[model samples]
Target: MFDKFLSIDEEKRQRVINAALKVFAQKGYQAASTNEIAREAGISKGLLFHYFTSKKDLYLYLYDYAVKLITETIEQFVDPEERDYFERLKQIAQVKLSVLNDHPDLLGFQKTIFFEDSAEVSAELKARSKEIAETAYYRLFADIDKSKFRPDIDADRAINVILWALEGMGEAERARHRALGIDLDIPYMMEEFDRYLELFKTSFYK
Candidate 1:
């Protein structure tokens, strides 16, 4: 289905994807209008269908593309030698932010997709969400050096707590930004992550 899309100029292909992403992020699969997407991409509705047969197909295609993009980005920038859990996480966040620079709607759209209640896409999203949860976080900490943690501390528990804190902080940041009608600044958020991680290390490190 994407063969025709692939044959197009790279910039044009991305324009379509970005246009679809913006609409999907705001309206989700059930309510997103292909007419709106085509207009946003500066193409006709007929051309959009020529590229993607249906709204469902477009949503799934974009979902797969976004997931692959982020997974590849993380794999490239997250170093295996960075055994410090917090440092590795910081590196991962930075790389994710870099990706967000080009694909502004990706992260938010993904978050929405995972929790999307539409029956049309719920099963697929649930499966992908499970697959990601099983592989991603487990791999990140699989070879972490536990000795750096205090001898009295439970290493796994400490790692879990840190992960929870980071996730909470991210959600809070998104919520705050939404409430204030401000755009998310990746560097600003990274700085906040650094401050929290440093304080956490002071308390937890040997």
Candidate 2:
């Protein structure tokens, strides 16, 4: 499914990333193998090694790509600029759910890092992931002036709320998928999200 991602240049790097994303997204970090990734990429195993020295290397490469994709999704599209900041927060929640829908296995891969008792994940990957997340959070936080929000609202606490919302939304969806043995019905999810966001708007916004 991810062939043609092994193109031979910088452009191809993005292709490799997409290919890696597909593989890692499907098999996850611990179970994913370099040979399998290479086969999926339509490249020889030796060529895959030439591009990424080890399974860990390919994983970190894809992890960086994922961070950029998630961060950029928030920074650019989550809250359209013409909207109120708190309303934009609702948009952020919706956009987060959309991203999770497109990449359902992402939560599983992410959970592996926090819950795994093994050493499949590298320390560097975790640190870099944290760095990207913090930068994105600060960027989103800067979008709104604290004074403009509810008098009782705390900016740092709000940031924590955002983190909780994003992660929890994904976790909840993953749990539902496991329990039901089917993909999440995202249209219904968005409908419920809009209902709650409206409630938040009514109570929390001036």
Candidate 3:
């Protein structure tokens, strides 16, 4: 689907991708301007369109690219053999933080996609988000050591609750950082996340 974009030299392709990610992350879908993306990429609008037929195409392509990159990075770093659920989650979080630090714009673009309400792409984004969430849940949790969970508790339910709590916490943290106009403080965020994991472990573990 992106043969033209993929065929370009790596440096040029990355420039376009980085520029588009920055614009979309900063201004969001509806407000993001192709002209600005082109300017930032050091290319003309016509050339940008030559690679991507429309802004929607470029946005969706970036979504797929960012998700694939992040997922692959996590798979590379996370220990598949570790069966302790909380420990695995912590490892995954660490991997994600490292990726975010390396590609801040990619993470920002993903965050924008999460809250995007644009009519042009909202439905598709929601569908894609659901698919990704389902896949991630299975891949990340399916092999966990359920025996460690409290015998009185439903392991599946407890796992879902833990995931939901952590997800809500993440959203709240991001909102707070955005409200303050500050970059994510990785150490502080990880410390708080660890505290939450300890609480969940106490509640759910045997």
Candidate 4:
């Protein structure tokens, strides 16, 4: 019953969703109120409920929507002609990084939701997220040729390894800073991103 908003035009609905993202990210799910989201969107509180039944419903919808948004953003640059693993991997990484760059709120909203997750929260969101993730995994791996990856490398393991590396880049840098009590000397993130893609290319495809 809780389908993601596929038919809705983002241009029309984004005012609300984008506003809700900020409210939810800042206040967290428990503390965030619909009035706050409505105020942020400059809409009447009465109108907010017209779009969604409750804060939980809206957050769940946004969570599902986020998974789709992320994949669709990545799909735009995944050219079939760019079959070289490095070329393909670079494009994919660019896609992911660009999505994060443009929609930075998703990271915080997601962190809050994941931290607050429980059986009391919507199970549909959890199931849908898993389904979306599995589909993304299949789509990504389908683009790769088994012969290109290291013969000893487990396909699933390799995918998880790369995914974790992407997640760790910023956090690892922050951790280093905190441990030493010094400023970050991290190079340009995009350049690090480029270097990472090259590493995957050289290690796996070359």
Candidate 5:
């Protein structure tokens, strides 16, 4: 579907992707302008549309591209032999930090999609997001060593609880920063995340 876009030189393709990511992350699907994206990419709107048939198509393509890139990066960096659950989660978070260091706008674009409410792409986004989440949960957690967990507790349910709690903590922190009209403090966020992981480890580990 994106053969034409893929055929472009890497630098030009990245420019387009970065421009679209910035526009969509900021203005979201409903209000983001293709003209703005084109201008940022140093291309005409006609050329942008030539690569992507429509705005919706471009937005969805960006989402898929971002997910694939991030997923691959995580798989590459995270140690598969680390069977401890909390340690695995910590490694995944560190991999994300590395990805953000390289592609600053990618995380913001993904967060925007997570909270996207635009009628134009919300349904499709929701379905894709659900599928991605399930696949990620299975891939990341399914192989973790169960023996580290408390013997009396169900490790599966305990893992679910820990995931939900950490997710809620992340959402709350994002909301707090959004309310303050400031960019996220990644270092501080990581520190807090580590603290939460320690707490969870104390509770769940034998």
Candidate 6:
């Protein structure tokens, strides 16, 4: 659908993409307005539809775009050689936070697409989400230095616990930010992650 858009000016294409991301992220697929997206992107609603056949088409495009961007960012920044699981997770978190800082709507946009129930493309979206998750899980543990883990702890379980704890902490931070009506502060969030990483390392590393 975006073939024509891609063939056009790169800057304008990105403007529309970002505008759609922000709107869909804020209001979800069912509620997002093409008019608002076009206005935000400084394009006509007719032009926006010209680029994408419809709102669903634009949304699916954004989903693909967001996943590709995140996958590329993780691949570029997360070191494959770091053997310590907590350290690797810290690196992943840092890269993720940086991306979220630059594209504040991306995470929200992804979460919206993954959980949306009423969309016609829900099945395809779920499949794409699963594919991304599987790929992420594989990359996260692949080639990690397992020797650093304490011998008594089951490596798989340890990794699962670490993942759960980190996710919980992140959710807590987001909740706090929401309650306080403050934007996510990357520095503060990273500091919290650093503290968690050190604690996990102290407990889990041999």
Q: Give me the candidate number with maximum lDDT.
A: 3
What value does the lDDT take at residue 131 in candidate 6?
81
TM-score versus the correct structure, for each prediction: 0.70, 0.66, 0.84, 0.65, 0.85, 0.71
Candidate 3's clash total is: 0
lDDT of 6: 0.79
Summarize candidate 3's per-residue lDDT along 90-196 as a digit string, tens digits: 89888887897788788788768756768999898878877887896568778989999999999999988887887798778878877897766668978999999
Candidate 5 lDDT by residue in tens digits, 1-206: 98999999999999999999998878878789999999999999999999999999999999889878888889888898999998998899888788867776887787677566688898988788778878975687778899999899999999888878977887788688778977667789899999999999999899
Model 6 residue 30 CA deviation in Å:
7.7
Which one wins on TM-score? 5
User: Please, what are the lDDT tens digits per residue for candidate 1 over residues 79-165?
Assistant: 889988878878877877778677758866764664466888888776875676678757767887888999999988887788778
Clashes of each: 0, 0, 0, 0, 0, 1
Clashing pairs in 5: none
Residue range 69-129, candidate 2, lDDT tens digits: 7767877776446346566666776676677667755544444443332365667765775
In angstroms, the error of model 6 at 79 is 2.9
**Pairs in clash, predicted candidate 2:** none
The candidate 1 region of ten consecutive residues with least summed lDDT is 107-116
Comparing 3 and 6 on TM-score, the stronger one: 3
User: How many clashing residue pairs are found in candidate 2?
Assistant: 0
- Where's the lowest-lDDT run of ten residues in candidate 6? 110-119
Better of 2 and 6 by TM-score: 6
Which digits, one per residue and each the tens of the lDDT, describe model 6 over residues 1-206?
46788897889888888898989989988889999999999999999988899888888888888867877898898887776677777787778767877877887786576346665878878787668656765676688887888899887777777777876886787677667967556588678888888887888879
* lDDT value, candidate 2, whole model: 0.64
Local distance difference test scores for all models: 0.82, 0.64, 0.88, 0.70, 0.86, 0.79
